[model samples]
Every structure is written in structure tokens, then in C-alpha cells.
Target: MNDTTWTTPDLTGHRVLVPGGTGAVGEGVVRAFLEAGAEVIVPTRSEERSAEFRTMLGHAADEHLHLVVHDYTSFAGAQDLVEQIVHFRGGLDSVVAPIGGWWQGSTLAEITEQDWHSAFTVLGTTHMAVLRAALPYLTDAGAYTVIVGDSSAWPVPGSGLVSMEQAALLMMQRVAAAETGSSRRVFSLVLGPVTTRHAEGFVEAKDVGTVTVAISAGPVPSASIGLHDHGEVQTALSLLTAGEAR
Candidate 1:
């Protein structure tokens, strides 16, 4: 987290779509792809949000980066996004969804109906929509990667609802991998406390960016990369991408 410098992967000719690419962590993913020489398309709910994202990118914003106004949370919205990507980028080589929000409330037993609805509908449903809509357009060696948190791997007392849905998304990754076969890859990156505009702690946004770039660039060694220990993500990725078994 201290070092601001990291190596980016080579992704020339790669076309990527990042839904919700305006958020703190999502921006990292977007920057990584652009720096890695990939054509990146990001979707935002409004033109204002897209403009804000462009501002954040500063010099990194170029013709390779596109900001589209579309909500990827609904089936129709995701379909529209896929259509846009196909028509614009000529189809996608990969999709990385750093899409999810952190919420805290009562314990599992005390969790209200609203809690369940909000967590599942937002985190679960949106991921399902994005993956379902993008699968057909993914290249033979393309990938669908989701950024997740530690709650999915370990119990987090009052964060039961978030943990449960995250775990479900982990399983969903496995299911997608199975259904898609070896033609496409589905994976998840589990991180420790990540610093973002929403929250701040151990991991920096650039660290997320570095790890994302390495993984998305190609031939991931594993389906799940756990950074809960807060290790040097890029180093691990180097080892993995060098053909080391996970």
C-alpha cells in the first residue's frame, strides 16, 4: 500500500467492459486495463457520473476508454450494454465487475426483511444480470471476473447478510466456470480491507488496480485469488502468471 508504483500487464488488442467503473475500486480496474493496452468500456448510470470518472482518470483517459450511460443491474440494461459493446468494441474479450457495496446492520437473527432484499437484489441480482448478458459476447478465451471481499470466505458477525450474499457470488463464479467450460474463465479476487472513497484501510486503490491488471491480462493460474493476508498482489500474480500452479 505504501508504494505507488507497480507494473502493468500487456493487454494489447484486448477489449474489456467494466460495469460500475466509476466507483473508487472500479476506477482502479479501469485504469489497469487502459494501462495494460486494452480497449476499455465503462458503464455509468448517468452522463454526470461518466464525466466524473473521466475527470478522475485525467491523462489516462484516451480513445481506448469509453464511458457509456447504461445501468448494468437489470437484465435489459445489461443486454443493452452488451449490444453497445458489441457494436462499439466489436465484442468483449473480458468483463470485470468490481460491483458491490458494503453495508452494516443487525446480526443475522435480527436482520430485517429490508436487509435481505437490499443485499440480495443489489449484490446478487446485478452480478447475475451482467454475467448472463455478457456470456454470449465473451471471446473463447475471455474471462468474467468479480471482485469480492473477505466476508465471503470467513464469518463476520454482524455482517451476515453481506457475507452470505458474497459467498453466494463466489459459488456463482464456480457455476459460471462450469457452464462456460474452458472456453471462458470465471474467477473472483478476495481482498482484505481496501481503501476507497467509501472506506479506507490496509489496501490501496492502486494495489487493486495492479492485481486486476495482472489477472485480467490472461491465463490466470487460479479461479480464486485470496489477498486477505494483504500480501503483495502483483508479486503473487507474477508467480501465478508464470505458470505456477495455484
Candidate 2:
């Protein structure tokens, strides 16, 4: 590697917890953290799938990068994940919560109770749980990030529920950021629609495969960004770990 200031991320010794970290983009974030010499913990409910994720990481799946099987659906589950991280390698330095689900195109009139609950669980509730769990560990030195979508920033024709949750999350993050201010850095990963298989429950099953690509590439006017896209993740890592160098 070149001796450039930006080549290596700033997370030299931080411990990062990535909720729903095994998915495509989330995995990319995990890998980026690992590359930055940070200890990466992936927590999810899937057991065998967690191991499979390790295998999928090729050769970088070492002791520093680990996976934990835990439910992220409630407050208690989030606490359990935090405890597991503490048991393994101390406390959390930062958290990357990316529980993206229930993201299909549905008009406000068509949204149902079930849909609302699902979106809340994936978008709002997950962030709530993770933040509550991380409260004890996060301080003036650490930060947390909630992965969000560009729809949160702008309007979409048939994404009322999504827009609602997205807007709520942005507000929550901003509030936390304001409260934390220079003490802690609460950030948001705002991106446009992504083209990947991670949209299993979010998209209309049949329309997902085809339309997702179209949405990513065509005149949807949405920008598709990834965790390992080289810009955002690196900067995030730097911000989270700058204390290490100091």
C-alpha cells in the first residue's frame, strides 16, 4: 500500500458492531472495518448462515472479524448482542445498524397494519434497539450510524411508509447528533435504491430482480451506493477511529 494518508482507514483499534452485517452491503462494511484494523462483530439470528458468511469472506475471515447469532427484533435482543460483544472483546466502539427491510413501492392508501409493523421493525425499531443497547458503551469517543436511504431525503411516488420511517430515522439521528454534538458522532448512511438480492422481503418478489436493476441504472434518478464504495465507509471509519491516533 502507498504511504498515503487516506489509504488506510482511521479505525486502528476500535471494535465495531454491525447489525444485519452479513448482507451484501453490510458485509462490505464489515470488510472495510477489518481492513482498517478494527475488530468487526456481526450479529444476527441466523446460525449456519453466520458461518457461511465467514466462508464467503474468502481469506480475511480471521479471529478479528467474528459473527454472533442473536435476534435483533427487540430491546432485550439488542442488549444480548451488546453483552456478547463485551464478553468477546470488551465494549463497542461504534455500531453500523443496517436492518433494511419492507421497502416495496406501496401507496399510502394501500399500506396495511402488517406493512407498517414490518417497516417499523426493520427501520425504526431496529435502530431503537441498537441505540438503546449501545448507550452504555457509546460516549464522547465513540459513534453510531444508522443506514438509511435517499428516499428519506426526498419524495417517491409510492413510498409513503418508507418515506415516513426514513424521515423519522433522519430526525432521530439528527437529534442524537445535536445532543451528542462534539461529544459523539451520530451519522446516517443515506443512499438511493440499491441493486441486490438483499431486498428479499422489501420488494415485490417477482418485480425485485428486474425492476431493482432498472431502478439502479435507469431514469429512476436514484443514486445507488454501496458500503465498500471507497468514499463513505472510509470516511466513516476515520471519524469513528480518529481517537485512536490521538
Candidate 3:
């Protein structure tokens, strides 16, 4: 890993959608994309949440950030959101979905129906809904990236549902990549404990955003990349930056 940070790619005039941009990790992703000069649209169900996010972003939210107060948890709502974006922005160039949640509960065998529905079903469905709704409209050369946790590969005892749901999302990205072939790019970013604005960890949220923006800028060798720590994040960014230079 290098000691320096990767430079943000120039994404002026590009239109990108980030569905869960109100969350901590998503905030970094949103900021990085906006800094890269992309017209980033973030959807939220609450206007108050939108206001809060804008405040969090400060002046960065002024020009290119589009905060839409809309619910994108369901298929119909996701489709509508995409339609509205296309109609307004003329077209969408890319998408970065960092949508997820944590759930701590009993073992899988002892988990309740409500817990399963909330942790596994709802989170997984939201990702699928956004993918299905946005895939058709995504530019042929554009990218669709999914952000998941390392729990997908490593079992978390109390958060078994988070692990299961994250694994499912990883598989979904693989399938989508295979189905799309060379028409479009699909990437899965598997992260470990991330350092967000609220917590400390090996991988920082800004680094996550940087790698994600790099992926959107150009093609990568593989669809799945692991960002477990600072070293891994730097390696990925270096590889991506090198690819862009070519």
C-alpha cells in the first residue's frame, strides 16, 4: 500500500444515483462522487433527513447533489425514482449502492420471523429492487457497484442475519455481472469494519468512497474486490488508477 491518497477522477456531466446516501458510509460515497464532478442524486423518504444530509455535506451539496424525498424501498418506488432521474437529468451514467443495516440477535435457528423479515428480507429486497429498476436504463458503458461487508464471507455469531443478507448481496452482484457480460460493469466491494463518522476501524469511509469512485471511472480486472483495511484500499485504488491511465 502507498502512503499517498488516490486522486479523484473527473466525472463532470455524469449522472449517478446513490439510494442510501443518508447513512454514514453512504455519506462518504456521496461526497466523493460529488467531488468528482458527477451529478449525484440521493433518495430519502424524509425531507428532514434530506435537510440533515445537505447540512452534513455543507457547500458540497450545492451544485451537483440532488436530494429527492422519495421512498425507494419497493420495486415500484425504485422504478419511479429512476424514471424521474432520467427525465430530469436526461440520463444516468452510474450507480453506487451502499444500502445495508446491522442486526444482532439469537442464532439463526432461534431467530424470530420478524427479525428475519427485517434483517434479511427487507435489506436484500431493497438492493434487488434498485438493481432491477436501474439496470435497463444504465448506460452501456456505465457501472453498477454494490457495497457489502466482510461478514458475507466470515460468520458473525450474533449478527448471523447480517452475514446471510450480505452474502446474498455478493451473489446478486456476481450474477448481475455475468448476465450483463460486456454491456455494462457490475462490481461488488466487500468491506470489513469500516471507520465512519461515528466509529473507528481499519478502513475509512472516505477510502471506501474513493475506491468506489475509481471503479465508476473505468473498468476493473474483476467484479469482486475486498477492502478489508487501509492497505487493501490503497492497493485497489492504485490498480484502478493504473487502469485509468491506460
Q: Estimate each model's TM-score.
A: 0.90, 0.74, 0.95
User: Which regions of candidate 1 deviate over 4 angstroms?
Assistant: 1-7, 229-232
Minimum summed lDDT over a 10-residue window in model 2 is located at 208-217
How high is the CA lDDT of each candidate model? 0.79, 0.61, 0.87
**Candidate 3 lDDT by residue in tens digits, 1-246:** 245555677999888999888888999899889889999999987899888889988988868899889988899989999999999899888899999878899998999999999999999999999999998899854589999988999998989999999999999998998898878788899988888888888888878888888888876633788988887887788788777421
Clashing pairs in 2: none
* Candidate closer to the true structure by TM-score (higher is better), 1 or 2: 1
In model 1, residue pairs whose N, Cα or C atoms come closer than 3 Å (at least 3 residues apart or on different chains), thus clashing, are none
Sort by TM-score, top down from the best: 3, 1, 2
**lDDT per residue as tens, model 1, 1-246:** 443444456788888888867888888788878888888888888898888889879999988898888777888888888987888777788888888878888898897888998976677899989989998788854577888888997887888888888999899888887877767777787888887777876777667766766666657633777764346575556665674425
TM-score, cand. 1: 0.90
Error of 2 at 214 (Å): 31
| Pairs with steric clashes in candidate 3 | none
Using lDDT as the measure, name the better of candidate 1 and candidate 2.
1
Superposed model 2: Cα runs more than 4 Å off: 1-5, 10-12, 139-141, 193-246
lDDT of 2: 0.61
